[model samples]
Target chain A: MPPEPDNIPDAGQAEEIAELVAKTPDTLPLKRPATPVFVPATLPDEPVEAPENGAALENPPVERPISVPQAESVPSQAVSVVAPVAPEPVSPPAVEFSPPPHQTFRASLTLELRCATPDASIRYALGAADVGEDGTLYDPAAKILLTQSTGIAARAWVNGESGPLALAHFEISQPQWEKKEPLDQSDATPHEISDQRALEGPWKLAAASVRGKLHAHRGGWREDAFAHDLAPAADGTYAIVVVSDGAGSAPLSRVGSNLLCRETLAHLRDALTQSAPLSTDAQELRERDLPLLRVVLVEAARHALQKLNEEAAKRARPLSDFASTLLILVRREWNGQQLCAALQAGDGAIALWNDDNTLTLLGMADHGENSGETRFITTVGMEAELPSRVRFSIRPNLHAVAAMTDGVADDYFPEATRLNQLFGAVLPLVENGDAPGAALLRWIQYEKKGSSDDRALTLCWRDDAAPQPETVTEETSDGHA
Target chain B: MTSQLISWKVRDLMTFPFLSQLGITFALSAAAMSDIPPPETAATEVAAPENSSSDGGAPELDASMRRLPVYLVLDCSGSMTGEPIEAVRQGMKTLLSELKSDPQALETVWMSVITFDSGANQVMPLTELLMVKEPSFEARGTTALGAALRLLLDQINQEVRKTTSTQKGDWKPLIFLMTDGEPTDQWEDAADAVKAARVGNFIACAAGSQANEATLKRMTDVVVRLNDLQPDALKQFFKWVSASVATTSMNIAKSDAPVGLPALPPEIVIVP
Candidate 1:
């Protein structure tokens, strides 16, 4: 006799499979090739009642007519009608019967499980770009108009050691207007661009050391290991480190990131070392030259991505398949004092770790809350449109800083909270004997794992150990969970 | 009894609420109360937002906004032989360049030039810096520095009046009386005019070796010893002037109101 039909509510595919197995009885003589296994026609027409344990089941079924397929075999259909056995245990019952010796038994099992996997990570190394040497990075993709008048180059690493990439050349074009009288503005120069003023004393120029790493996105485990140290000059000069990440989606992001770090260092050094008196004030410098530092850096990154794309395209690849972000750290020590500055653009975060367990954000992270989206500087153009770039400043009084891409930062933390976490993780290192950059890297890999995109960091520190001032005692809720 | 009553009246003025509203300090009230008077200490101790008292101390303007009165006295005289004439022309260019380096110089300095060859001629009238174009420097005959000096005194008076006309703050005017040779005309009257005005106002100085030291002695004792006629010295002098002007201007800018008198270098002598 055939076994009695057991009731099974429809859930999702998992539930349907479970129900089908439970409904099948072991009393009937099993058929050889065509066994009577129930093929669920659409999900059951009834709402799936919650399981006894209250675990979520399949979606509630919408009201609809149930259409069950009739059995092909008359014998099987008759057996079901003829057989009337006690209902199977409501809890779980297992029934097994040996298949006919002459018939071969075939079976298949299917189960479903849901798990969130980490994303792909892109680590950066270093790269550089020469303005006007190649095509001008003035197009929207480059987001800057660089000219020969303002000669500047930038370098940085994208993800880990893949780069020391070269960005496109960036420059500031000369003004159409010229001054006839020493400072008199000629009609050619139509308007004053910005307030002309120089930064005053109490504002310091110095260097700091920062360290950090990037967490891997699943299998693409990359490491961002870099270091920066600042030494004081008797002449009150400085050495700095500035890094820019290429769009992770770019083909040569690693190269771009590294290139940016090196080029920025080299350019700033060359510019300052030429013994050119820093236009004693900010106003003097602005008038004598263009405030193209920010734009130049962006353009350089874009250019690097472009060249890498071109090279990759020759090999049949999409540009920006591995682009990264950008960061800058500058240090100068003078008169027994240190002055430093750090800037970041894209998904990276910069933190200052102090001796008294204080942390500050040197760069900001982009949160999708404002517009439900986050944007980054990228090498690739969508329909020929480039992404935006950002700039920030830091100075001598800076204790220590860390710059890193999102890959190492926990996405669970809101932008503000993540920044706090970044500061928290790196602050102790700067305070401790640990090198700022190195400590930050370790924290990103070990402390902040299973996070977001690619990561990169750079740090600068003072050589002399002047006592740090007392830290502010105000408690802040700005830390990461 | 009368003096005591006067003191009480002065105290009332000091305590009056109206002074504070106008951003003014009542010195009488504070002076009466304090046993010791504060010396003119480096201007650093003075409150930044408030103006320093003019008694015994030069008006303390915010260092960033001080204006300068620069009287460009040119020697359109016979002794301005070929090289000196060319040097003077080139010197103006250098001054422009040096001044431009300092952003504050543009706003702080009011430039005027007096040419004295056969007679004193006002080549350029005192004008607000933001409005006037650079004046052309011309050269010609005999040195009539005395006449030029007279004109300078009159112009200084007019400028002081114009500055006070607005009830705005004032800065000491600087007269850079330059000459290539001795005065060919009688200068006693002009010298007396400068000396009289010099009592509590204006910095009158002579600029060349050919300048009559005796004649200048009658005008204020301030004399710029330009021992070197080289173009470089001229450049250095102008640079110093520019820096001084800028320093004062910066101080002036720090306050809401301008200072009444800018501090001057005690009779600056441009050494070779």
Candidate 2:
């Protein structure tokens, strides 16, 4: 193999070589032995008969002895093999025997990935290479140094007793950009704080609810409630909506509630990406799948909470100011089944109205005596700590699943009989009607008159024949007390 | 904002792929079987025999060992924008403060930071850590790990090799190479140079949440996986680096000639 384009040393090759050498701490003694470099001129003519192949002896034999002069340039032993000098050498045979100008050495490197368990851990075939032989992996080229190609070939196998069922092959190459620049001495010139708050409708402050009866008063901050519905997609995939109620005690609850919904959406997307597909077999046991899905949801919640903590820490604000209750609903269309999983940690309600008119309360808050009855699962010491368990799972072909903050549950689930009646009326509206979200808003408006809090509800229903809901919806104008 | 959220979602999806990539397999140790070096023990200075074979006839670049040479080969390409770049900047400030806290760094620890944008730039040269102020960096451009590596290797060979005539010191040098993206430029030449210079003199590590570990593994075979591009983690990494260098420099200051330097933590997984 001939030398590749990169291997051909040009005019500045030596300078480049010298710079490579200079990057090191020259204090450490370079143990380059004083042995003379040797380049083999050619093999001596022992007159050995050529084999039948004729391929081995294609080149004429000529030999050059190793002398002190030849050894000085290339001191390394790997490149120092030289043929013994031939005695009374006649004119060297035409350069037929000179070794090819350059021989490219290729080493087949394998990176195998073995998955110990399909759901657990995975290991790389080539764990870590000590290409530099030094304890520290200080060189960026170390990856290239170990593998033959500047690109390292890696293989991954999953579910081999270790973890997960997975296999993959990929190459790792060095960065094409330059190194990082040192920090500027100047103090960070503070920039304008990005107004990242997400809001619905016109008011910077507003409440979303199913009930529309409440109206605004003279000087109070509270006002009428509006219902905003997010329907299912064209592919029978309903959007999972979650409404988090900000703690009224903290001024930032409104902000935290909005952040919770936004962050939960982000987390749900992330979990879905990382989550393996749930086939029909898993869907059969949606009840059993709740535990695992719970862990995922709780983790997502914890992450969002941590982000809030970080924001507070950055601004030197107390953590409590950024606290809010999280209610999350996840729905997907998979394997000809619409799998809906709703999780409520702390104070929230998750209700499912089956197609058969039976209402199952998937989640409910601990409504105690305090005016703010239901409590968020936030403990004094456990900031961002994951809950012991999460409660959620897939529901196959349900009429609809609704998750609402405590404010709605308080006004809506006033009595067990009323709760059953409410489901009886609402499930049919969702099951029989063309527009379930509009129907839900009408029902909630009749049920509650005056409710002032960060109220929200997300209803997701899936049916092959259900009409596709538009992406955006018009906000309703029902006042709440 | 929605686009940002969508992109982040995509990034979240890549975590599995990224985790799979990190499942690297290679020999645990090449030279000898050793236990994980204890934190306290690794922090302590080890002395090599004054006339040990490895230390014999080692050329001293400077008459005085006070000048410490540190070459930072950083990734400042377009890929390392946003938090990654800002974290690096904050990390450098923390490193400077850490050095300032150490008396040895004040006397020694000459620093040079090299940034490879389209190509390698000597953003900062061999200035005394105490004297030189940190420079500003706005990361943007393609990654040229190869060119950057070659540039650092060359600078080390040229500038650090030319030592001062005042004191004969044989301090260990350090090189921290970090990037969050793959090499878009040709890297064969730099890889060859690194292979040639691996004589156990430098400590190189690559870091970044989005770094191409396989590429890093090839370059130095040693990769420290940073869980995030948080400023604190960077500070921790640099602190350890600075401590290791300062400790080694202290040893060199007390020695008459080259001595066996302390080893880095073995838990630091090396790329084979």
The regions of model 2 sitting more than 4 angstroms off are A1-239, A282-292, A333-338, A377-386, A393-397, A414-417, A425-443, A447-454, A467-481, B1-272
lDDT of 1 by residue, A75-161 (tens): 111101111343222211111111101111111101011001111011111112121113211111111111121111221111111
Candidate 1 ranges with C-alpha deviation above 4 Å: A1-234, A244-246, A275-322, A333-343, A352-396, A409-418, A429-441, A447-452, A461-481, B1-272
lDDT tens readout by residue for model 2, B2-75 = 11111112222343233222211111110111222222321232221011111112223222123557777788
User: Mind giving the per-residue lDDT tens digits that candidate 1 earns over B160-225?
Assistant: 432121122234565666665777888788778778766222333455565655666677665555
Q: For model 2, what is the error of residue A64's alpha carbon versus the real structure, in angstroms, after optimal superposition?
A: 99
Docking class of 1: incorrect
True contacts kept of 1: 0.00
Cα displacement (angstroms), candidate 2, residue B42, comes to 73
Every model's DockQ: 0.01, 0.01
